[model samples]
Target chain A: MKSLSLKNLAKTYFDAYKGEHVTAIRDVSLEVPAGEFVSIVGPSGCGKSTILNMVAGFIPHSGGEILVGGTPVKGPGPDRGVVFQSFALFPWKTVLDNVGFGPKMRGVPKAERDAIAREYLALAGLSHAADRYPNELSGGMQQRVGVVRALANEPDVLLMDEPFASVDAQTRMTLQDELSRIWEERRPTVVFITHDVPEAVFLANRVVVLSKGKVLAEVEVPISRPRVWDRLVADDEFKDLSNQVLALVRSA
Target chain B: MERTSRISAALIFIAPLAVLVALWAVVVPVFGVRPQIFPSVPAVGRAGLDSILDGSLLRHVAASVSRVAIGTVLAVLVAVPLGILMGVSRGVSAFLTPLMRFFSVLAGIAWIPIATLWFGYGFGAIVFVIFNAVFFVVAYNTLLGVSTIPMTLRHAAASLGAGRQAMLTDVLLPGALPNIVTGIRTGLGFAWRGLIAAEMIATDVGLGYMLFVARDFYQTEVIVLGMIVIGTLWLLIDRLILVPLERATIERWGLVSA
Candidate 1:
C-alpha cells in the first residue's frame, strides 16, 4: 500500500494585483509507498514545490485529494515533517533547542526530547554545535540542523522543498550523501522537490519530471542503493536516467 | 583583554566630559564670562555640594525618580500586553494605529495643563504626565513590532504543534521584543522631558521645581546643578539600561544583517 498518495491534485488562486486567476498545479497525481524516496524535478515555475507544500498541508489544495496512511490530509501535523529551502531555523533558538522543538511541542519530557535531539544532531554531525544559535552556524550547518529538526519529530513522511539548493555545490553533494545515509537508516517515505536533474536521479528511487503544473514523466532509477557519488555518476544507469529526466524537463 | 577594552571604552566616554570641563574652566575665565549667565565651573560644583549637604537635592531627585518609576512601570505593564493583543488582529491594528499615533504625538508636555486640572498639582499630576508620555509610544511601537514578525515563522510554529499559548510565549513575545524595547527607550525620553516640564509648572518638589524656584532667587548655580542631574540621569538610563536591553534582544532575535 502507498504510504502517501496525491489523487488528481490541483491548486488555484486569485492574483489580486493582476485581477486574474492563476493555476499553480492541476490534476497531477503520484503515490509513494513506505520507505520510498521520490524526487520531483522540473524547470522553474513548474509547481514541484507546490505539490510538496500541498502534501505537507502548509497550503490548501484547490481541488483533488491527498492521503497519508490512507487518511485524508486535513492540515499540517507532526505526522509529516518539512524541510524548507531557506533553512527556517528559529534564530532565537539554539541548535539543540531547534532540533528538540518539535518533540517539546508534542509534550515529550525534557530528558526524552533532548535525547531524541542529540541522536539526530549526531546523525547530522552537529553535536559540537548544539549550543550555538542558528546565526552562528554556516548555511550548510543550519540546513543540517533544519533536516534534523524535521527528523527529530519522528514523522512518517518527510517533505523537502529543494532542501540543499542554497548551499555551495560541494556542500550540497556532502549533504546529499548525509541525507541519503540517514534516509537509508530511518527508511521514512520522502517526497523531495528540486530543479536539478542529476540531484533528483542521484538521491531518489524514482524521479518525477513536471512542467506547466502537470507531471510529464515518472522515471525509475535503476542505479542500486548504497550509492557513492563518483561511482553513481560514472554508471550507465545513472547517465541514462539523468538524460531521460533532463529531456523530459526540457520538453515540459 | 575584555576588561582592558571595557576600561578603555569607559575612558573613551569620560574623555569628552573631561575636555568639556577643561574648556569651560579655560574659556569662561579667559572670556571673563559672568556667572549669572553660566555659573563658573567651581560655583556650580559648590552649589551641587551645598544641595547634597542640605538634603533638598536628594528630595527632588527622589521625587522625580519615583514618579518616573511608578508611571513607567504602570504604563509598560498595561501597554505591552494590550498592544500585542491589538496587534494580533489586522482590523484592530488598523483601527487603533491612528488613535495611538495621535495620542503619542499629543503625549508628554502637551498633557501638562489637562493633567494638572484632572489630578491636581502634586504626585498625581506628575505621574499622569509621565504615564501619558510613555503609554502611547510604547503601545504603538509594540503594535508595529508584532505586526512585522514574518508569517512564515508563525506557520512554522503552528506546524510544529505549538498551540496558542506556546505561539505567544515562544514566537509572538520574542518576535515583538526588539520593537517593544525600542519603544520603551523613545517613550522614556519623552516622559523624562515631560516630567521636568510638569514639575516646573504644577509641583512644589522635584528637579524641575528646584530649577524654577532657583530662578526666583537668581541662583543660576542651582539651575546648572539641576540640569546636570537631569542629563546624567537620562544618560545613565539610556546607556546602562535601555540600550543594553535593546542590543541584546536585537542580537538574539534579529535576522543577521546581510
Candidate 2:
C-alpha cells in the first residue's frame, strides 16, 4: 500500500514581466509506499525536484492533490524533514543549532533539544564539529550536518532533493555508506531525487525513473544491507541496473 | 588577508590623511590669508580649548549624541518588524513598495524644513528628522534584504518544519541582516548631515548653530573647528560603530564571502 499519494499534480510559472505562462509540471502523479526507500532519477529540469517540492509543501500545486500517509498536505510541518542539494544549513547557526533547528522551532526545551541534536550528531559522524559553522566545514562535513539535522527531527518521511550532488566522488561514496547506516537503523519513508544514475541504483530499494514529468518505470532492488561500493561497482546486477537507469534518463 | 594584515591595512589608510594635513598646514601661510577668513590651525586649537574650558562643548556633544542614539534606537525598533511583516506577505509588499519608496527618498535633509515647522526648532524637531532618516532607510533595506533571499532557502526552511516565526527568525532575518545593517549605515550618514543642518536652523545651541554663530563674528577659527569636529565625529561613528556592525552581520550571514 502507498504511504504518500500524488494525484494529478500540476505546476506553472507565470512571468508577469514578459506576459507569458510556462507550465513546469503537468498532471504528474505517483505513490510512494511506507518504509521503502524510493529513488527518482531523471534528466535535469524534468520536473523531478518540482514533484518533491510539491510533496514537501514548498510550492502550491496548480491542479490535483498530494497526501502524506492519507492526509492531504496543506503546508510543511515537523513531521516531514528535508535535506537539500546545497546543504542549506544556516550559516549563522553552528552545526549543533542547525541540527536542532526543527526541535527548537517545535518549542523543545533547550536541554532536551541539545541532547537530541547530540544524538543525531553522533549518528551522522559529526559529533566533533558540533560547534563549527557550515562555512567552516568541508563539503562532506557540511552534508553530514544536513543529514543529522533531518534525522534529529525523525519525521515520518525523509525528503532528499539531490543532497549528494555537490560533493566529490570519494565523499559521495562515504556519504552513501553513512546514509545506508542511518536508513537501516531507522527505516522511514524515503524519497530520494537525483539526476545521477549510479547514485539512485546504489542506495534505493526501488528506483523510479521519470521522463518529461512522468514516471517511466519503478524497479525494485533485492540487494542486501551494508552494501560495499567496490563490490557493487563490479557486480553484474549493479551494472545492469545502472545501465537501465542511464538509458531511461538518456532517453528522457 | 590574515588578521594582522587586515590591521596593518587599516592603519595604512592614515598615511594619506597625514600628508593632506601637512599640505594644508603649509598652504595656509603660502597665500598669506587673513585670520578672519581662514584662521591658523593653532587658532582653531585655541577656540577648541575655550569651548572645552566653558563646558559647553561637552554639553553640546552629549546632547547631539543622545538625540541620535534615541532616534536611531526607536527607528530600528519600528522599522525591522514592519519590514519583516512586509517581506512575509506578497500582497502587502507589492502594495507597500511604492509608498515606502516615496518616503525613503524624502528622508533626512528633505524633512528638516518641515520638521522644524512642525516641532518649532528644538530637540523634538531634530530628533524627528533623525528618526525619519533612520526609519525609512532601515525599512527599505530590510525589504530589499528580505526580498533578495532565494525562495529556495525559505522553502527549504518550511519543508524542514519551520513555522511562521521560525521561518522568519531562521531564514528571513538572517538573510536580510546584511541589507538591514547597510541601510542603517546609510541612513545614519544622512541623519548625521541632517542633524547638523537641522541644528543650524532649528536650535540655538548645537555644533551647526555654534559654527553659524561663530561665522557672524568672522571667527574662522571656530568655523574650521566646528567642521573638524563634525568630520571627526562622523568618522568615529562610521569606523567605531556602523562599519563593525555591518561587517559582523555580513560575516555571520556568509551572503558576501570574505
**Tens-digit per-residue lDDT, A134-252, candidate 2:** 88899999999988888788788888999999999999999998898788888888899998888898889989888776777778877877677867878898898889878878887
Alpha-carbon DockQ of candidate 1: 0.56
RMSD for all candidates, in order, please.
Answer: 2.0, 2.5
lDDT of model 2 at position A141 = 95
Q: B62-138 in candidate 1: lDDT tens per residue?
A: 99999999999899988898889887987887888788878877888888888889999999989998999899888
C-alpha lDDT of residue A66 in model 2: 87
lDDT of 2 by residue, B127-206 (tens): 99889989988988888889988776677677667877878888899888899999889888888888888888888878
Over the stretch A1-252, how does candidate 1's per-residue lDDT look in tens digits? 138989999999998999999999978999999889999999999999888888878899999999989999987877888888988887878899989999999999999999999999999889999899888888999999999998888888888999999999999999988988888888889999999889998889999999889989899886777876868767888888888888898999
- At residue B4, candidate 2 shows an lDDT of 92
